[model samples]
Structures are given as structure tokens and as C-alpha cells.
Target: MFSADALIQTSGNIVGGTAGAFLGGYFAIKVMRTQIEFQRKQNQQEKEEQYEKTYWLMKLVFEGLGSSIDDFQKTMNKPDIDDKKDYPYLIGLLKGTLSVSKEKKELINDNYIPKDIYREYLAGITLFNSCEFIIERWYQTLHLDNFKISTDNYQFKDLIVYGNGMRHIFNEIESIKPIKKKVTTTGGGAK
Candidate 1:
């Protein structure tokens, strides 16, 4: 038969061991949950940052292209300039210089832009470049004595196509543009 004191000591040890195990498990779970919550918050913050970067990039491209398009249209609408006498000057004015930075280009090139916007961005670039080519070809006609640049040139057909295509792309970009958040304030008085 076991001694009474030894049996009580053994019982105390068993209870202490079980309680220790439960407490340790509880703490382990709490730590895991805390770590998981922290990771989730970190991931959400990163996504928000990326969204801001993409929005800014798109805005920059949109404004730049808008300005370039306006300039191109204004230069093309000039009716007073003599085509034959100011052909070179007119050619310079018609140059489609839609300059984009390498980083901005990489957004589309490297597939950073969303899949939906990707096709429109590429189409915009192609139309812009095509317009440039058409202007260059028209300018080269100066070498030919009979060829005179009038309101109607062979490139006009292609230019019209480019113009329509650009309009579509611009609409797409405008649709995706982020809405600016407005801040509201209550009445304030300094005095």
C-alpha cells in the first residue's frame, strides 16, 4: 500500500502538470492568432499602397495624353497657314510627341496594369505611334514636286481611324480614373 503523504504529493503533481499543459496551449494559440492578425493587416496595407501607385500612374498618363491630343488637334485646325510654304513648320506642329516615361511604360509592359485596362493602354500607344508614322509619311511627300499637302491627304483615312481609336481609349481611361474624395468641414471661426 502507498503512503498517504506520497499519494497526496503524486496527486498534486498530476494536477499541476495538467494545468501547466492547458495554460501553455492557450498561450500558444493566442500568439498564433496575434501573429496572423498582424500579417493580415500588413498585407492589406501593402495592397492599398499598390493601388495608390497604380492610380497615380494612370492619372499621369491620362493627363499627358489629353494635353498632347489637344495640341495635335489645335495644330491641325490651323487654316491660315500655307501648306506648301509652311509644310515643314506644319509638319513640326503635327508631330505626335506623346512622350511617356520608362517607368510608366513598364506598368503596361510588365503587366502591372490590370488585365481589363491592358488592352486599351496598348491600343492607345499603337494609335499614337501610327499617327506619328502617318505624319512622317505626309511630310516626306515634300520631295515630290506634284504632291502638295492639302486638307485631304492619303493619310487622312488612317488618321481618322487613329483618332477614333484614341477617343475610345481616352474614354476607357476616363472610366477607370479614381474619384477624388471630398472632405466636409463644420463651421469654423477664428475670431
Candidate 2:
């Protein structure tokens, strides 16, 4: 019952509607992909910033605590000195420098840390914590437990041992490029 012109117009309307829907869907998908990529880039930048920040913090800590006694030794020109006789005194003298501020604690946060590199940060911080622990224990042994100056390098050696390993691991982590973690599966799903 429709005229030829009316039928053509109806067909054109249907085609136009379908094409518009398809194009709309396509653009929506493209926008979503762009947003996702943008988010990923933003996240990557944040992670890099966090990595640099934490790295510098640990580096300062290492310089302050790791080499404090050694620096003193080297400065005092007593590399040949017996660690047993000197460790406690060194700890006592350096006790004032071994402190944690609120700002330092804020650097070791969970929010900005990437999931793959948590262990690396943890290892570095553990080294730092070990130094603090050793200093406190030595202080306590002298003041609280023994109530006398005990010259021993046991605590110092323990902290230094962990610190050496921590430095190695931290250096390795620093060398790693900030790319997606790749895993090679050798048939057992081990990454």
C-alpha cells in the first residue's frame, strides 16, 4: 500500500539507524580502550615515582647506618681494630643517629608500591630495621640487661650480614627495568 518513494524512505531510515548504532558502539569501545590505556600509563608513572622515592630513602638510610661505624673506623684509621672491643662503643656512640621519623615511615606505604616489587622494598627496609634493632639491643644489653658495657660484635655482625645481602638484592632490584613481569613456564606453571 505504500508508494515507491515512501518505501525507499523507510528503508533509508532503517539503514541510517543501524549504521548510527554501529558507529556509536564502535566509538564507545574506542573511548574505553583509550581510557584504559591512559589509566595504565598513569599507574606506571606513579610506580616509577614511588620506586625512585623509596630508593633514595633507602640509600640515605644505608649511608647513615650501614657505613656509620665503618666510616668511623676508616676515619679513625683503625681498620685493624678488633670489632669485639669496639662494636658496643660504636653502637652507643651512634645511637642518637638511629631514629625513624614519621616522614620516613610514610615512605614505606602500601598504596604506591607495585605488587611485583614489594619484596625488593621489604628487603631493603628489613636491612634498615635490622640496623635499628641491633643498635637498640646493644643499648639495652648495656643499660638494661647487663647494666655494664659489654664489648661484643655479635649484634653488629648479624646486622651487617643482613645488610650486605640487602644491598645486593636492592641493587639487583634497582637494575631491573620497570616492565611487566614476564614468566617462562616450563610445563609446571612456575613463574
**Candidate number of the best TM-score:** 2
Scored by lDDT, model 2 comes in at 0.63
Off by over 4 Å in 2: 73-93, 100-106, 140-152, 177-191
Q: Pick the candidate with the highest lDDT.
A: 1
Error of 1 at 121 (Å): 4.3
Clashing pairs in 1: none
lDDT of 1 by residue, 31-141 (tens): 999999999999866654665576566555544544554555566568776656776665555553433522464473324455556677777777766866776776667
Each model's lDDT: 0.64, 0.63
Q: Cα RMSD (Å) between model 1 and the true structure?
A: 4.7
Candidate 1 matches the true fold with a TM-score of 0.61
